[model samples]
Target: MSKKPIKRLAFENLTIEFGDKKIVDNCSFEFPLNRKIRMLFNNDVNKYAVLHAFTQVEGITQGKYFFNEDDVTQFSFEEFMSYRLNMGIGFSTRGLLHNRSLQENLLLPLMYHKMMSMDEALEHLKKFYEYFDISSVKDRRPAEVGPNMQKATLLIRAFIHEPEIVFLDNPEMLLSKGLYANLLQLIDDQVEKGNLKHLFFSTEDEDLSDCIADGFIIVKKNKFEFVENKKQMRLAV
Candidate 1:
C-alpha cells in the first residue's frame, strides 16, 4: 500500500528563562508527522511555558527553538508570521470573536487563506458544521452556543486553511471523555482527505497522545526525547 510522504516540520532544543530565572531548560525533540497521521502536540511543561512559546515576551533567558527542522535560536516578527502561515496554532486562551454568529467565525479562516468565493466559503462552512455536529445552529451567536460547540467551531476555523501543521495546546482542557473520540475523528478526517497536519499538546492524558498522534516527543531540559511505545492506537475507540 502506498502511504503519504511525511516530512519533518520542526523540532527544537528549547532553553528559556524568565527575568534571570530559567524555565524550559534545554528541551529538544522532533514533531513526527505523516499523511496517515500528522498532529504535532505541545503540552506546557510549566505554567509559564505557553506564554513563553506564544509571546516569547519573557522567560527563556537561553534556549534554542526550531520549526520545520530549522533552528529558531531567536524569534523575529517577519519569520514568525511566515511560520504561522505555513502551520496552524490553536490555544484555549486564544480569544474568539464571540460577537459574530458561529457561521461567521467559521468563515474567517477561509477568508484569511483567500480560499473559494463566498458561495464556496458557505459550502465549506456547511460541511464543517456537519462535521462538528453543529449544522442546526450555524446561525447562532457564540454566546448562545455551548462550550463544546464554540471549541469545535474554532477548531474547524484553524484547519480550514489546511495548514502544514495545526497546534492544539492542551486539547483536553475543555474536551470531555465522550468528546475525545469525536475529536480524534475530526482530526482523522483531515488526514484521510490529505488536507492538513496536526500538532497536539497535552499533559495529563497520555492516551490522547496515542489517539490522533503518529508519534510523540517529550520535552525536558530544552530538548525533545521520544519514548518507545509498542501499543497500537485504534481508529475508533
Candidate 2:
C-alpha cells in the first residue's frame, strides 16, 4: 500500500492568558493526524479555551500556532472564517441559533461554504442524517428540542460540510454513557474509512481515551503536554 500522508497541526510555545491569569501556559505539542486524539481537560473552562484556540477565535499571548508548517498564530477574523471551511468545530447546544430550525442550521455551512442550493443541501444531508439522528427532528427549532436532539443538531452542523479535520468540543458532554459509547464507535468507524481526522477535547476520564484514541493530550496546571503512555493517563492526574 502507498504511504499515507503525514499532516501536522502544532502549537509552538503558545501562551494563552487573560490579563495576568494564565489559562494555558507556554506549551507546544502536535496532534497526530493519523489517528484520533483525545485532549483531556480537568475542567470545562480550559477545554473550550483550547477549542477557541484551534478555531482562532481567541488569540494567544505569545508563540506560534501552525498548520502544515505555516504560521497561523494571528489570523484575522475574515482569514479564519475562510480557513475554517476545511475545519469543522463542534460547540455546545448553546452555540446553536435559537431561532433557526435544525435543518436550517445544518444547511448553513453547505450553503455558505459549498454554495449548494437549499434542495441540494437537504439532499446531501440525507447521507448522514441517520448517523446523527437529526432527520426526524430536523424541522424543530432549538426551543422545541431536548438536549439530546439539540446535541444531534450541533453534530450535524459541525459535520454537514464533511471537513477534513473536526474539532469536537465535549461532544458527549450532554450524552449518557451508553449514547456516548455509541458515539465513540461511530467516530472510530468514520476514522477507519480514512476520510476524516478528529481532535476531541473532553473533561471525561482516561477510560474514554482508551476506547478509540490512538494518543492522549493532557492539559494540567495551565500547560498542555502529550502523555506518552496512554495507559498511565488515568493516573497522570
Candidate 3:
C-alpha cells in the first residue's frame, strides 16, 4: 500500500485585528503544497499584518493556523520555536541582527538550534556566499554594508537553513537586477532539490510575480481569497 501525502498549511476561520481594526476578517484559505504564491493586498498595512501573522511574528485575534494538520496557534513556546525553524523569512526592512556580523547572523539560527557545529555551518554557508557573491561583506555588520549587500545577506540568510517554507516580504525592494536574478535562481534550485516546499512573497513588482508565482492569495473585501494562476492552469491544460 502507498502512503498518503500530507496536507499543506492552512488558515481556518482566521481573523486578525488591531484594537478596533480587523485586517483579516474570518478568512479561511488552504495553501497548495510545494507551490509558489504571491500575496496581493490593496493596503500596505494589511499586507504587513497578514505576512507577520503567517510568520507568527504577530498574534491572530481569532482562528487557527494549521500546518500539516496541526494547530500552530495553540503550540507551546518550545513547540512554536521548533515550528519556526522550518520556516525561512525575508523581511522587507529588518531581520538581520544589528550587533552581529553578516556571517555571524547567518550562522546564529543553525548554531542556536544545534542543527550543526560551527565548522559544519560555515561549510554549509560557503556555497551561498559564492552564489550571492557577497563574501566580501561577510565580516561586516548589517549597518556596515550598503543596502544591496544588506539585502543580499538577508536573502542568503533566508535560504541558508534550507527551510521547508520561505516567506519573503518585498524581496526585490533593494536588490539590484543581478542580485534579484540570482535570488530567483537560488529559489528554483532549492525547490528542484526538494529543500523548499512552499514560497509566499508580497511584492509590488508585477514582473517578479509573473516570473515565479504559481498561485495567488488575494485580500479582497476584507477577506482572503485563493486564486489559481491562469498561467499554471494553461500550462496544465
CA RMSD per model (angstroms): 6.2, 4.1, 4.4
Instruction: Order candidates by TM-score, high to low.
Output: 3, 2, 1
TM values, all candidates: 0.72, 0.84, 0.90
Indicate whether candidate 1 or candidate 3 has the larger TM-score.
Answer: 3
Cα lDDT tens digits for candidate 1, 1-237: 112223654434456665555556655555555532322233434544633463332354444555544444465655455555555555554456878887887787667657668899988777666666888888899889777777776677667666656666666655557777776777778767866655544434667765655554545434454543424222211
Per-residue error (Å), model 2, residue 196: 0.8
TM-score of structure candidate 2: 0.84
lDDT of 3 at 70: 79
lDDT values for all models: 0.58, 0.68, 0.80
Per-residue lDDT of model 2, residues 94-142, tens digit only: 7888888988888777776555788888787886676756678889898
lDDT of 1: 0.58
Q: Which residue runs of candidate 3 sit more than 4 Å off their true CA positions?
A: 1-6, 230-237
Top candidate on lDDT is: 3
Candidate 1 — worst ten consecutive residues by lDDT sum? 228-237
